[model samples]
Target: MNGRSIATSAMLYTVTAATLVFIAAPLLVTMSLSVSDTQFVSFPPRGFTLAWYGKVLRDPDFQSALSFSLWLASFATFGALVLGLPAAFALVRFPVPGGAAIRSLLLSPLIFPVLVTGLGLLQLFSMLGWGSVPVNLLIAHILVTSPYVVRTVSASLMLADITLEEAARTLGASRWRTFRRVTLPQIAPGVAAGGLFAFMVSFDNYPVSMWLADAQNDPMPMFIYRKATGVFDPSVATVSTLLIGLAIVVVLILDRLVGLRRAMGM
Candidate 1:
């Protein structure tokens, strides 16, 4: 409506466009490289083909790494949910002494550097004789991912109306029944969002997995790193594109089931 207002709007639009380009440029380049007919990684790819995708898909090592990564992410998400739900309820619903301290302790994993956390876990596990690679990795992942669940679920709990629970209790409903019928529905979006974050974090994790993973239990990130370093080719780009595609699909599904803004506590 006014010159100053128009100028502000134009500046905002420019900044938004620049930010999106900054974020999307790398993904676009990676996707382009994945389809490049060139035998090696190159920008402004010469021609286009999907052979790299096919080759990477058919590779046994790739298949194994993908499978392991999926399994690890699923379990880590589940573990995060298991620990997060009760912690969230307690933090949100109860007036416990030293509540802030407890919450900080639970979320400290997120504050500490992941590389340091991984090293510490590795040393602790060795000292405790926890030799199973998969088990140790799962525990470490759970520790890191649970903080997401705690944060999301606690936010949801704080926003959830207390009246519904009280009304259910007035009707002689048990605590568990009230939670199942009323509380869970309200917080389902938060749980879903938290689980999605946990899964993605675990799937993409390299620093933590680097310390914990063995040759036999290597996840996709480690596998990709090895592939990229060992052979400079489009296949690695193909793998990365597939991962990006997976993340997009997962987000689309979540957005369909639960409004993305609501799920994300926006």
Candidate 2:
């Protein structure tokens, strides 16, 4: 190979390594601290033990936070899928006047400041007299996560042949039947990928949830933030490590099921 090709390959390798290190550094530190025998968070743990894991498992507050997070992620993802996929189909099958602007509006959540969205939701809900604990959180999560579903399903629709649906319809198949058999399978992977992203968004979200959830309804991320600020306990590390692990597990499952490379445009 030419020297230019060699230099390009070396540059790519360096960038890849740097990116991996940047992402993994915090996770590695958090995992190490979770095992540390010390009560405080520290790097290069003085001693190692499993007590932090035990403490986390036994803690009711941790359990409640985890449960709330799971519930939020699941419900929010479902809401996004139900809302986004139809909108995607309509946008593609029957483009409206000003459709390009409409698509941008659909994805506004992706670019808007999350903190501002949180404040807006808080104000809107307060005006409507429903700024209670979990409802506000659910509303914010759904808003943030819907964009992922819209973007993903729209990509899948673009890749799928519109003729397949038309052909099915011409052959005595009802539109609903055509979609159920011909259209849905082709885009199912993309939908799943979008749902995975939605779940991850809800799971990892803090900025909007921070404003919405009360002390009683704080999700796991909020719980971690509280502990990190208040107690600085090893269990905070444990909780973070678990959240990271959960994200990895969900990604792996989806990767195996749908081949993440294709869903991600790789």
Top candidate on lDDT is 1
**Cα lDDT of model 2 overall?**
0.90
Q: List the residue pairs that clash in candidate 2.
A: none
The digit string of per-residue lDDT tens for model 1 on 149-233 reads 9999998899999999999999999999999999999988998999999999999999999999999999999999999899889
- Candidate 1 local Cα displacement, residue 221, angstroms: 0.9
What's the distance in Å from true for residue 250, model 2? Answer: 1.3
Q: Residue 127 in model 2: shift from native, Å? A: 1.1
For residue 171, what is the lDDT in candidate 2? 93
Worst 10-residue lDDT window, candidate 2? 131-140
Candidate of highest TM-score:
1
lDDT of 2 by residue, 156-256 (tens): 99999989999999998998899899999889889999999999999889999977889789798888888899988788988888888888898888889
Per-candidate TM vs. native?
0.97, 0.95
